[model samples]
Target: MREALIVWGGWSGHEPEQCASIIAGMLEEEQFRVHLENSTSAFASPSLSTMSLIVPIYTMSKIEKDEIGNLSSAVRDGVGLAGYHGGMGDAFREAVEYQFMCGGQWVAHPGNIIDYRVNVTRPDDPIMHGIQDFAYHSEQYYMHVDPSNEVLATTTFSGEHAPWIEGVVMPVVWKRRHGTGRVFYSSLGHVAKEFDVPQMRTIFRRGMLWAARD
Candidate 1:
């Protein structure tokens, strides 16, 4: 069985524990040997490299240098990393290395919790296949993303919330590589309940599996 690690902590507003639990349940159902930890220290485990995948549900938290270094090494060595929303994107705000590995960072969410649409930009990608454009009544993330990311989905700002960004198209989902590891991320799942949306759930599951090359 493939081994997966899920570490949750940091901002409670993101409901880290609950988010970790939701993903853990999905991974378990997929036959992954899921290990859940509530502390970032878990990233320091010497055996972290053995993991087939790692999902972090930490937001805006500070991670130690050595701990993050181990994580970076593990991913570069082929351990897949996948995450969603601010939990992964906004995590380690002070750690540029972590942001680079994630391929993006959450900068703002205009019109906090409003109706928006997520367009499927790469429907042919396995992670997005069979999923159509969907509407979300949640925070629409405005992020600073790595240009190298293979964008799979996107959202165009309506300018109703933020005038300057009116026509800006931002990446909602993307996949990239950090050395030998596949990295996947989605600017969704602000709260645990967001996973209840079928499209959101499906995309996330497929994204995680894709990252692990499962």
Candidate 2:
């Protein structure tokens, strides 16, 4: 069976623990041997490279240099990495290398929790197949994303919150690669309950499976 490591903990405002539990249930339903750890130190595990996937529910936390290095190397060596919202995008603010692997960083959520629309960009992509543009109520993430990402979905900023970015289109979901590894990210799920949104939950599930090592 494919194995996955879910490391959760950091800024409780994001409800990392709750989100991790929800994701763990999802993975368990899929029959993955899921391991849950409530600490960043799990990233340093020597077995990281052997796992089929890694999910980070950690947000805005400091990761040790060696820990980050191990995690990065594991992904580069062909393990998969997939996550959503601040868990992956807003994690390790000072770890540029980690951000690079994630293909984006959550820079801001201009209006905080607000109504927004997610427009599917690459519906043909397996991760986005059958998913359509949908209304979302959460932080409309404005991110600094890698140009190389194969963007799957996007959202437009109204500038009501950050006037300078009015009408700017920002990536909402994307998939990319680091070495031989597959990496996927979505800027949805600001909180655990957001996972109840069918579109958001389905897209995340497919993205995780898509990023898993073959």
Q: Pick the candidate with the highest lDDT.
A: 1
TM-score of 2: 0.98
Model 1 C-alpha lDDT per residue in residues 71-127, reported as the tens digit of each score? 999999999999999889999999999999999999999899999999999999999
Q: Runs in model 1 with CA error above 4 Å? A: none
Worst 10 residues of 2 by lDDT: 205-214
- Every candidate's CA RMSD: 0.6, 0.8
For each predicted model, how many residue pairs clash, with residues at least 3 apart or on different chains? 0, 0
Tell how far residue 175 is off in model 2, in angstroms: 0.2
TM-score of each candidate?
Answer: 0.99, 0.98
lDDT of each: 0.95, 0.93
Extract clashing residue pairs from model 2: none
Residue 85 in model 1: shift from native, Å?
A: 0.3
Model 2 scores what on Cα lDDT? 0.93
Q: lDDT tens digits, residues 1-214, model 2? A: 9999999999999999899899989988888999999989999999999899999988998999999999999999999999999999999999999998999998889979999999999988888888889999999999999999999999999999989999999999999999899999999998989999999999999989988944
Candidate 1 collision pairs: none
